[model samples]
Target: MLRESPYPMVSVSEATALIMAHVQPLRSEEIDALTALGRVLASDVVSPEDIPDVPKSAMDGYALRAADGLAPRRIVGELTAGGTATVAIAPGEATRIMTGAPMPIGADAMIPVELTEERDGMLYIQRELKPGDYVHSVGQDVRRGQMVLAAGTALGAAEIGLLATLGITRIAAYRQPRVAVLATGDEVVEPGSERPGGAVRDSNRYALMAAIREAGCIPISLGIARDDIDVQRQAILQGLDQADVLITSGGVSMGTRDLIKPLLAELGTVHFGRIAFKPGKPTTFATIGDKLVFGLPGYPVSSLVSFEVFVRPALRALQGDATPFRPQIEVTLAEPVRPSPDRPEYQRIIVRYQEGRLLAVTTGSQSSSRLLSLRGANGLLLVPAGETTYPAGSTLPALLTGQLLL
Candidate 1:
């Protein structure tokens, strides 16, 4: 039922380049560091003071000069964690120190309590000790006035811990974007609604909403629009008023009921009608003033694939993320596969480890409408159009989407 379009198809690379040319990073804002998880930093964070400003004991042990090893020494005093040991340790003298306690002055070494015996105010070493053993030197982990985190770094648990260590209560971060989602076609009914004859459930609406949330954007559902032209135009205009980007599903194809393309022509400039790619060939990108619009296919699998390939990057760009593309690695194919003759294919694949090598297994049936093709898939094999068939053990670059085998 595919119908030809009047516009010429563009390569995926060319389309990506054109799309990026219009991207401008959103403005920056300041927020509390505790609630800034997954947000991109707007400026570099510098350490105000060196971590562990003084030499500290890495374990509970006796602190003394290494030359006094294996010799009966007088226990001068006991130092616990969080207490300063300003008393100096002379030859044949030792101080009982707890973990994280500052090392006593003039102490060159530490012997763990297990390797020492104490009785009647005297401490005895079980074996010889080396200087600097079990002792953390000053500024060992971090130096003062050093760049702890760079701009555009995504804040995570580790990043938050680093900020806490530096006593930074607030940080400059980019604002999250609001994305509008609209579903098309009268045959698409809401879930739990009465199913009329030949009507299918509207899965794309909720699915795209979850995908938008996963990309760190707030999703605004514009409700379902029938195949009518006026209804579609009104919905598109309303979506533009509330969202930084508009995403519509099921109305960009060449079918007679596909009103999204014609409506966009009257509202704004359509960058391209179709892309030279599989499963998402009918994908459309356009702009109306400062807002961006994307028209994705109606099929479940096609809709998800289009979001991963295009919408995810756009969301990241809005958050001022420098590198937005998914990480790709070369993996060996476990079975034979053929590439598309006219366009490149993004075949769903499961990446596994065998003999210390990463191998890709096809998820079977790359049909755009078959949602099962994406089940348990962690990678997408990018099979180019130049290759006719790739035999077993052939290497190809694949986009990683799920947990890594490592």
Candidate 2:
């Protein structure tokens, strides 16, 4: 016999708040700076010394006093980058310097080689020069004891380059969370295994694994567990022991065989067992001794959608990201769509820029079991529960998932 779920269904916002309340950033660890790309800094990085501590030439030209304008000066010596200045310029004298070479003691400006002519060891300047022109003065780019990067800032290519320039080889960064995925059902089998009648290949495990990786978390596969309560409990226990977050699919509904909800309650606290959202109404969240557990629906589309709506943000929060949610933008619908009568829907859409406006079109069929609906989709259009049909050109807000199509 089917039994009703004991937990009341809550709105998406309520569920998100409850989950976030339990989530906290992980502890920091020292790691090599070269491997810190995409990791959030746990502490501020201050410059130990000023960038370009000495005055350097910004162009390959002659370095001389600005007072000697457009005058023929004797080129005493040549200065290349990484070579020390052997001769200093005096009045009516100049030195041939390359880009990034340290300026001599008496030189105050640089003229580009393109604007000067060299004849018989004499340099003739074509353009008038001014002091500090084409010269990188001391501490011009960065000052000493200045905060170059703040805590909670995500490291990128440019940030890594800056750290290299500042001689910062190691960094303190938040540890990436490890998520374990468990697929439960008696009718499920591995992809390579032969499928018998009434048996289906397991796709949720791989899909959830990919989604976890995309969220910047490490994914650990817990394999599939049978519908038996004892088997599911053992699997869940092992998963909790090995991972910081646990995600299970196919046993969270109200069916008699559905056992994840009861098991979670017994093992920990179930914050919310159901959401008032379509395609993922039975999604459940819980906390087990500082670890998080998410029980998602069995359908492929529903599982992925729930991950995007809930798990992704949680992972980001664990890494101390200030903006944990996906970016949301207003978009215009390209066709008519019928809203769910009882619950709000997250419809998969392909968003593109049409002329000057952002237009979105729904992937055909919006069915929870059709995983193809997510292919080439870049946004999730939020449709409110209503009896009326939303006609073409209706403007609504959507959560961005990927790059917008031009």
Candidate 3:
């Protein structure tokens, strides 16, 4: 259960500030080197030793003493990679060394073995040998005591390969936030289950599960809860007790069946509900004890948007993510859009590149229950709730959901 009220009703910014003011910094966890791709490193990892640790040959060549190799050369010995030096080069002789073979003692340079000719136990140098020619110097690719991987760098294929080169077997990363989801509604039933006369298939929970995974969090599903307050309370409390965050769809409104708000008041104080947004107007969030509870509307689109705005950021913060919000860009509408004076709208839109400019076309219908409207949409066009009848081709600001310019 939460403590006393921090303040009165706040705008989105104030509410977010008051809510996130005291969230503890994320902690690091363990990750095997192989499974560390796409995870941020928890600490700086230096190269344990100089890469390639030895001055080796880069080509099939002959190792010889530089001062004695002014002219021709005689074959003295052969050195394969991993083989010890059995014979050393004298003044006029050279050793046939394979690629990656260690430079032998007293050998100051390497010449391509093919460049030498021999007759009657004498070696002929077909080409001039320069000091340090064809020899891979020690630590050319990477040096010892170098800070190869900085802390907080997101590991990629190249980073992983570099770590492997340094013999890093494992690393520390931030533990993924554990999220639990519950769907509550007397009219809700599992998808593919027989929907009784008044029941609707449970799609929001599945959508939320997918979204949670995409956001890089672990989703622990607690299944569905019915309309009864006692059942919903028990399920919510149980979820909060086990998960770092609890998300539920439905029962957050003021309807007779709505129970999430009252339960939140009984447990912890409600942070805020009913933000100034369309389709997702019923969005509600609270801190149930220490677990964040997000009450999403039962409608598919509304629930998805609520998760996008609230739970996604909280999960990112819990994971030590530097930037939790999606990218937004300004665009001109291809056609006019009339917006409600009451709630801001994130209208689904299709974007296209025209003459080096991005143009957006709104999809059919703005109803919160329409799922197909968002299928091919690249991003949402945010229209302010205070405006109406935006003119076609006007420079009304639109939020590009795909990227963050910064």
Every candidate's lDDT: 0.88, 0.93, 0.77
Tens-digit lDDT string for candidate 1 (307-332): 88877888888888878788999999
Off by over 4 Å in 1: 1-4, 67-70, 83-87, 126-131
> How many pairs of residues in model 1 come into backbone collision?
0
Per-candidate TM-scores read 0.94, 0.94, 0.76
Measured with C-alpha atoms, the lDDT of residue 162 in candidate 3 is 92
Tens digits of per-residue lDDT for model 3, 1-406: 6443232433445545655663543689778977677676778888878767877787987888778746666777889898866776677777788998988777878878687765776667776667788888888878888888776566789999998888888888777778899999888898989989988999998999999988778898989999898999999989988888889899877677889888988998787876666677667788866778888999898888667665676776677666666666677778988887876677888777676667888888878899887676667787877665888886555545553221
Which pairs of residues collide in model 1? none
- Taking all chains together, the TM-score of candidate 2 against the true structure is 0.94
In TM-score terms, candidate 1 sits at 0.94
lDDT of 2 by residue, 143-178 (tens): 999999998888899999999999999999999999
Residue 129 lDDT (model 1)? 80
State which candidate, 1 or 3, has the greater TM-score: 1
Pairs clashing within candidate 2:
none
- Error (Å) of candidate 3 at residue 187 is 0.8
Q: Is candidate 1 or candidate 3 better by lDDT?
A: 1
